[model samples]
Target: MTAKKIGVAILFIVGAGVAYAETPSSLITGYTAEAARATPGFAPSAERGQSLFMRKWGVSKTMPSCATCHSDQPTAEGKHVVTSKRIAPLSPAVNPKRFTNLAKVEKWFGRNCKEVVGRECSAAEKADFIQFVSKGSQI
Candidate 1:
């Protein structure tokens, strides 16, 4: 095959791979279900979750606030250009599948907290965080 033709073929393969990536909605839904059951007091605090979402953690080099990427509303979605995925909304009211399990919740919190907060959130932080996010919704 010609060089130009080879390049085009490679591009097509890459594009197809991108198209097959999982949607953020499904990922977040899975994550939420796991969190609700795994983390204790996951259903209590909308206010604290709101604060955590808006607050920037880390003492010296401040990490970006969750709102920086996620917006002020927990149930709202946001885009991550690097990941090529839209962040799923957090509220049960907005997402019918929000809370179902604990494993998925811990998994996402472990991953996302490190990505956004620059550290793995503590158990207390996770609880407060879940409470903060699950707040105001009928869970």
Candidate 2:
């Protein structure tokens, strides 16, 4: 093949690999790294994530906590408290697509954290949350 064709083929292969490389564990690693940079010795904690999930911030009367819409059990379906829209389980074990996309994860966390936590969630919080839900809420 010509050099141009070989370069294009290599780009396609690399791009495809990158597109499919995201996973829950990878996301946790990324967030934990980010969190650690901010707070030395930081590690993702499922317990902290659960607390964040179940805690009632009372910031939004309609949506006080992550569980308000995600349900206490990450594996179970939930409905929007206001819109009444049905929501799928948050656990990657139950919903394999939950955190495989960093963009989608960021979008949801950005919106949900503001609505429930009253601010954008920190990297540590995101890491903790991904760690918790990736375990299917057994913790």
Best by lDDT, which number?
A: 2
Whole-model Cα lDDT of every candidate shown, in order: 0.54, 0.82
* CA-RMSD of model 1: 13.1
The runs of at least 3 residues in candidate 1 whose Cα sits more than 4 Å from the true structure, single-residue gaps closed, are 1-45, 58-63, 136-139
RMSD, each candidate, Å? 13.1, 8.2
TM-scores, each model vs. reference: 0.55, 0.86
Off by over 4 Å in 2: 1-16
lDDT of 2 by residue, 52-97 (tens): 9999998999999999998999999999999999999999998998
Extract clashing residue pairs from model 2.
Answer: none
Residue pairs clashing, model 1: 33-100, 33-101, 34-101, 34-102, 34-105, 35-105, 38-102, 45-131, 46-135, 49-132
Per-candidate clashes, comma-separated: 10, 0
